[model samples]
Target: MRIHTLDLRFQGIPGLIASYLVESGGEFALIETGPGSTLAALRSAIRAVDVDESAIKKVFVTHIHLDHAGAAGWWAQQGATVYCHPNAARHLIDSSKLIDSARLIYAEKMDSLWGDMLPAPAERLIVLQDNEGVPLGEVEINAWDTPGHARHHHAFVLGDVCFTGDVAGMRLEHSSYLSVTASPPQFDPVAYVQSVDRLMAAKFKTLYLTHFGAVSDVAAHLANYRQRITEVYERVAAGFREGISTEENRRRYAAAEHQAAMQAGVSEELWLKGESANVTSMCADGVRLYCEKQP
Candidate 1:
């Protein structure tokens, strides 16, 4: 089986939302459809890799997040069997609620930013429980429950590569650069740590992150990710102990992240434009999750 990386140009940034196409024999499987608005990028990337759009007979989504599974329903409408976590099955079939919730969080740019998400008919959506193995053409993807990033998250292991969604966190380009974005409401720091450990124990040779491309040294990366996330949350937890207000706390937290990124050797220009915002948002989410778990 051959795996091709389809980079979705999220916010015009490369490697931000990578979808993969796994090929075997005469069939192909698309993993993570990216955001609905970014389907064109997905299509173009697939085509560039010599994989026909219609050859994608199945889709395995790690979760139902807009950036990850937003286009699952759309592709399912095109005759691809959509495979997802059982808890996310209903949402894929009737994405109205999920779309609206994302809109509330993302606001006015929801449609323009993420594109339209067409619901997959219930019959076309395949819901798999943890440890379920589903056939994708000639390959069998072992879908294991990989929650913590989200309750419904699943990581698919095919051959030597594991398509680890956000459960593996962000690994931006070279430089051992990493950041964990554990968003609020559903973000559980403890669960996230456990999930990291679970992935580490899996001993996969390489991990394909939704944020970018492949990461080898899976164990080391997971360790660094866990450490970074812990530090971010610990900083926030310490603030909570001092009774710091949310607004002040967020400012302080963002500032510290900015300095850390700079100290880590990230360029000043990149930090000002994109990297900084990503780290700040990640830190904010990590902070929120840590506080929620405290006491």
Candidate 2:
């Protein structure tokens, strides 16, 4: 089996987003669909690899986040079996609730950032279980529940490469700016740490992140994810407990993170682009939400 990394080149940002196309056993599978806005790029990328869209017999998603699965419904409509966590599988069947939840976070940028989310037919859904290997003739694709960024998150292990959705965080090329993709609602530091540890302990040494490309320094990356995410959460939690407004926390965390990234040698242009492209404020907001839930 061969895996080709497809750079969606979201919003003209070179390394901000990616999806993997795995060809094995005379079948094609997409690990992530990216947002609907990138579907044209994705189609083009697949074609460049000499693989037709109709050859994609299966689709695997790490989560239901619009960035990861916004075009999943479209893939399902292409006669491919769609596999996702049960919690997320239902939303693709009827994206009304999913769109509502996203509206709460994205607001007016809905159509611009992610585009329209269509509903997939229920028959195309295949809910996966933790540690379950997908039944793909000659290829072994195992999935495990990895909830940290989101309760419905999971990482797929295909041979030596593990598709670490958001659990792996964001690390752009040419810069050591490793930022966690801690979006709203469910961002548990504990779960995030555990998931990172699980990925490190797994047999797969190469991590294929949805945010970017392949990362082979497994130990260093997982360690950074554990330490830095905790630091961010702790900083934001203090503001949340001290009655800081959400807007204030966003500003504070974004500034602090910006300084840290520059100190770590990230260029100003990339830093600013990373902030907007990665939505750095949302990570702080996620930490604020976690702090709010605490008594």
Candidate 3:
């Protein structure tokens, strides 16, 4: 199986988001369609490899998040089967709720940020359960329920390579800084840790993150991600306990993340760009919600 990492050049920033094209025995499958705004970029990337967008008959998404599967409906509309976790299937079949929630957060910047989210046809939306495998030509793509960043998240596996969606967090290439992508409404720290444990137990040789690209250091990456999730969650919980406001917590988290990136040899410009791509404020909001729900 050959995996091609397609850089969507989201917001004209390289390494911010990626979509994967898997080729096996002349058959093609797509993982992560990025946002609708980058549809043209994705098409260009695919054509760069001499493969037509219509040749992709299968589309797998790690989750229903805009950056991951925003253009999935477009693929399905082109006659490709859209596969996702059962929890995420309904949302894709009817994206009204998802779009409304995102609109509330992004408001007027919605179109530029994520573009339009179209609902995938119900008949074309294939829901995969945990441990189920979908045949993609010679290789089979397996789906594992790896909820953490979102309740509907899944980590797709092919042989020893795992396409870890946001459940594995965000880590840019050449930078040792790994930030926990805790977004609101469904970011459960405990569940996230458990999902990491699940991934660790699988012992995959390589991990392909949708945020960026491949990670060959699977063991070290997962371990560090698990530890970071714990550290950030505890810090947010402590801040809430100390009566810190959500905005203050976000400021503190962003500052700490910037320092970590700097210590890891990331340039200030790149760090700022990454911060803009994956806003740390959402991380604070996610952790705060998790803390509030605790007994």
Clashes of each: 1, 0, 0
Query: Which TM-score value belongs to model 3?
Result: 0.98
The order by descending lDDT is 3, 2, 1
What does each candidate score in C-alpha RMSD?
2.0, 1.4, 1.0
Candidate 3 residue lDDT tens string, 112-164: 98987888899898999999999988999999998889989889999899999
Q: How accurate locally, in lDDT, is each candidate?
A: 0.80, 0.87, 0.90
Global Cα lDDT for candidate 2: 0.87
lDDT of 1 by residue, 177-259 (tens): 57667665577777888888988888889999888788888888999888877777778888888988777777887788667
Q: Global CA lDDT of candidate 3, please?
A: 0.90
After superposition, the stretches of candidate 1 with alpha carbons farther than 4 Å from their true spots are 272-279, 282-286, 293-295
* Pairs that collide, model 2: none
Flag clash pairs in model 1.
Answer: 37-114
Error of 2 at 53 (Å): 1.0
lDDT of 1: 0.80
The top-ranked prediction according to lDDT is 3
User: Tens-digit lDDT track for model 2 on 1-295?
Assistant: 8889999988767788899998877877899999898999999999999998998888998999889999999999888898999789888899898899888777897888888788989999999999999855578899889999999998999777899999989886746768888988899999988888888787577889887899888778888888888999889988877998989999999899888898889988888777755687888888888998888
The positional error of residue 241 in candidate 1, measured at the CA in angstroms, is 2.3
